[model samples]
Target: MAFGARARLINPRLGTYFSIFAALYTALFLLVLIFEQLKFDESFLRIAFLAGPIVIYAAIGLCVGTNDILCYFAAGRRVPAAYTGLLLGASALGGTFIVAGTGAFFFSGFDAVILLMGTLTGFVIMAIGLAPFYRKFGAFTVPSYLGRRFESRGLRVITAGIAAVPMLLVLSAELRIGGHVAQRLVGGSANNLVFLLALTIAISTAAGGKRSFTWTGVAQSIALFLAVLGVATTISVMVTSLPIPQLANGPMVRGMVRNEVNEGLQLIKVWPMAFQLPPEGFSALTKPYTQPFGSIGPLAFIIGVFAIATGVSTAPWLLPRVAATPGVYEARKSIGWATVFSGLALLTISSAAIFLRDFTLDAVMSERLGPLPQWLHNAAAHHIVTFDQAATRLGFAGLKFDRDGVLFALPLLVDLPSAFSYLLLAGAVAAALVTASATTVSLAAVLGEDVIQGMSWEPPTTQSRVWIVRGFIVVVAFCGAMLCVTAPSDPLRLVLWALSLTGASLFPVMVLSIWWKRLTVGGAIVGVISGFVAGAFAIMMGEMGTLSTPGAIAGILGLPVSFALAIGTSLMRPEVSRHTVEMVRDIRVPGGEIIYDREMQRLQLRKHSRT
Candidate 1:
């Protein structure tokens, strides 16, 4: 009771703790920028900027390391909503959103808003429909929640195996992007850096599981916010003389539209599902910035948004973080806050893309300019932006830009202080590390607890279980890092693929299990298998170039089949028990003892009586 009281006292102070960390992190980077301006060695400064926060995050993880069962797995269920929200928001942004996602906006123009809308819409669904109820049940992993809800250990094990696919995909995406940023900083092989970054993630995750995961995630989020918003605001003030990037990009967009007309860019009305790229002699810069369906088709856009949003709503890594919150209401509130933070990060990214595009249109492609700017040359040296040898002045057909490197290249492109570029690099790495840690830890928990323990009739001791999870964290991080090095995909597409898989395979059954009490174990098992297979098939086809937009298409094919299968199967085998029906009814209520905990206690009592 005294410990609980002390925790309550500390809970409200979390915001203050994170705020101080943000201020100090910003101030340290500012000092580094000042040193760079004062003729300090660029190499040392780059190392310091990237390495400093990671060291602190590891220290924090070590300090918070725990063997207590609940705290290890769920942060003692004491984190305040605001901090939990920060954790969720930061993990959601990942390395992909701030890095490759920014590049997508720069190239795809209006078509990229589909990604933003999908993510924010997913947050809304969680806030209203999913998160609170999950909190009330208080399961450690999504598989555990489903397994217990259906009273089937086999279902839990099967779901754990299926869910690991998308979680590892997300982990690989974060590691790949993080390694890229690290390589940009230190100028070494990205494969080595990926392994190194994975070590850092393992340290942070294995130290305290979600307990350490939460605090490190908050620190990383603040770093990301400082770097991304700081760069956007500075560039906004320089370009438009306004500090707010989101509200100040209007004239820039109009400027782009006018430039597109001057360049004689014409839109091709392709079939709605056809894949389109800029025609030869045309580059992304030569296309209309405000036009829709210029790249991804209209049907693909809608499907992409739906897939991403649904995936976000049901992400195993994301939803389990809600278990750290104090109650169901706090979980809902945290999701609301997550929506705000992620939405802000995304909008700032779009605004930054606009200002960067404005730079290219006004300077790089200008007929009067004698040669490409030194910044573009520098970008090309980094292999960030490429140009055609046969390229003519004002013709974009000869230019190509790598989307994944755009965010790191933006400050240089905009001619900001080189220090700002390093700052952005640090920020991107932080985002990646935090997310990689979250996904790694989630995979470990799902496999370690939901699968290994669920398969055993006898539960392991609390210490053994914690050690088991820590061991799995290291293994999972290694696998993800190796995957990143071995078969790297575009980070943005990887993210979308993970979201599509999670949404397609898990969302329908998760929802039905909560609202439809008649859902039988056979129905759920079949539904999960069917959805996963369909989603995986579509993803493979897309990867093989059979589909224009595989991530979105996966959901379009998988969701309906899963929903139909689960419902039809349930109706066919209408044999749900009265107790399960009562449990589902209880979960929907906001205030109650955690339903999962009560059920576990009853099972324990029965076991004791039998023994």
Candidate 2:
């Protein structure tokens, strides 16, 4: 079993193989300091400058491109639709979604659990109601679908523009995250020109596309899941009986500590009826449930339902997977199970961390820390403190004064065994690679579908087209890397913004295109463009401290505006050709199987006619 696992984990490609070595080396380095007194220093210079960006980019390039690109080439022409779904799902596992969950954790605390339920609900509803139609259209790019639905060059341009801006930003965020992870691993020996690192990552990603991205995602998800599992499990065992922190420290303490603790316990208690929950406790679950349409909130439920329902087609990450395999439905059938298991696994890890976080914080505040030892950052609870400092205390060992840093600083203090430490560290690198590879390919496809082909530009040869795509990948990567090296933001924070923009903006447009037949060419074009602009507009505005509610609303209006514009305009404008309806009727085949029979049927018909 060990041998098989080793063989499976180790890749044959030079790039992947090199990354494996780096993982092992970094593990050894961490192992030496597993018991050390190193503090969590997350200053930009420490985290970003100290880490080598190019190498990290190169590593992800292997994971994302190799298998993903191979699978695409192997599919020949007219790629299967189901493979696209698989690829999309795989890509979905990257830093973006992980950070989305993290963002929810930050803003609303555990009370934000409702958001997770709502998100899942949205996906399920969309899948059952609208996925088939979106798949049927058989369009490869989001903009292509816009063209099919609206058929107006203006709409296509707008849709492309909408998709392009956020997509570029998304890529930038991934680079930032990947660079940070690389920097952390590289420790004292980071990189010079961050763009150089970005370009390196982009090149590797461009090299493989479908084949590489698929395998890389598989690698990233597996590595991350296992690493987090080990960490969460250890903490769980250590803190199973831990209680939520209460602020019995004073009158201010009573309101802040006790109420906070009590509310937290209500949200977390596995058995709800066992203990009485505060009135606020019940409301916490629905705090973010906005635009409620009456008591049971049928409208809100539909929002979740349709979001999930249409999620199947909106995420373009799945496209390469579709083109790679032979069976479409066969592949689609596998998604629910895959996502279910994966979601459960990740949730388990996340929940364990959350429980640990609350319990530990409470213990420290009340000075009830028995044998469990104060986490690294307990030093800074001082006269008055911030949650960031509280969270920082969760690390292995803290420098006397470094607890003021963000939650990401915990990584520097972990004390895993060499083997497992390397294994876990490898996972972060894997995450970067998976994302970089997927983004690189997706970026290439967009350029192909929207820029060149949209303009009636064609390469002189198949190879030339391939090279053009590769060239574009490198260029896009270069631009992203430059931003990473130069741009100033928390690496992980940067990733969150990237994913938030992409998902919030694009998801709505993709959702509308699927089932709402009234989602005319005009509608989809308007919707996608609106989603794009609204999402971007929010990100920039929020950054300037203009938005009053930091995360309470979470840009839900982006989706509504997208829907209203698409559907409203679709209804009002002269509808484009009925081609989009026809396209969706035919394009998709679910079940996610490896075999297809259409070619076989065609050959049989040809043979019979000859006879």
Number of the top-ranking candidate, with TM-score as the measure: 1
What TM value does model 1 have?
A: 0.94
- Per-residue CA lDDT of model 2 for 151-230, tens digit only, reads 55566555665555545655666665555445444443234434544555555556665454454454455555555555
The true-versus-predicted C-alpha distance at residue 299 of model 2, in Å, is: 13
Residues 1-611 of candidate 1 have per-residue lDDT tens digits of 85575466446667677778888787888898899889999889888887788888888788899998889989988888878888898888798887877887887788788878988999998888889999999998999999888888999999999999999989999998899888988778999999989999888779899999888888888888888998888887877898999999997787678776676666646567743432211134545778888877887777887888889999999998998888887898899899889999999998877877776666544565566566777777777778753444645545577776767666776577888888888899999998999999999999899888977535567789999999999999999998988898767667877898898899999989888889999889989999999988888887687866544345446878899999999999899898788889999998878887777677677777888
Q: Which residue runs of candidate 1 sit more than 4 Å off their true CA positions? A: 1-10, 275-286, 364-372, 388-394, 545-552, 603-611
Q: How many residue pairs clash (N, CA or C atoms closer than 3 angstroms) in each of the candidate models, in the order given? A: 2, 71
In terms of lDDT, model 2 sits at: 0.45
Give the Cα error of residue 83 in candidate 2, in Å: 9.4
Query: What TM-score against the true fold does each predicted structure earn?
Result: 0.94, 0.65
* lDDT of candidate 1 at residue 255, scale 0 to 100: 68
Q: Once model 1 is optimally superposed onto the true structure by TM-score, how far is the C-alpha of residue 511 displaced, in angstroms?
A: 0.7
The C-alpha RMSD in Å for every predicted model, in order, reads: 2.8, 10.1
lDDT of 2 at 207: 63
Model 2 RMSD vs true structure: 10.1
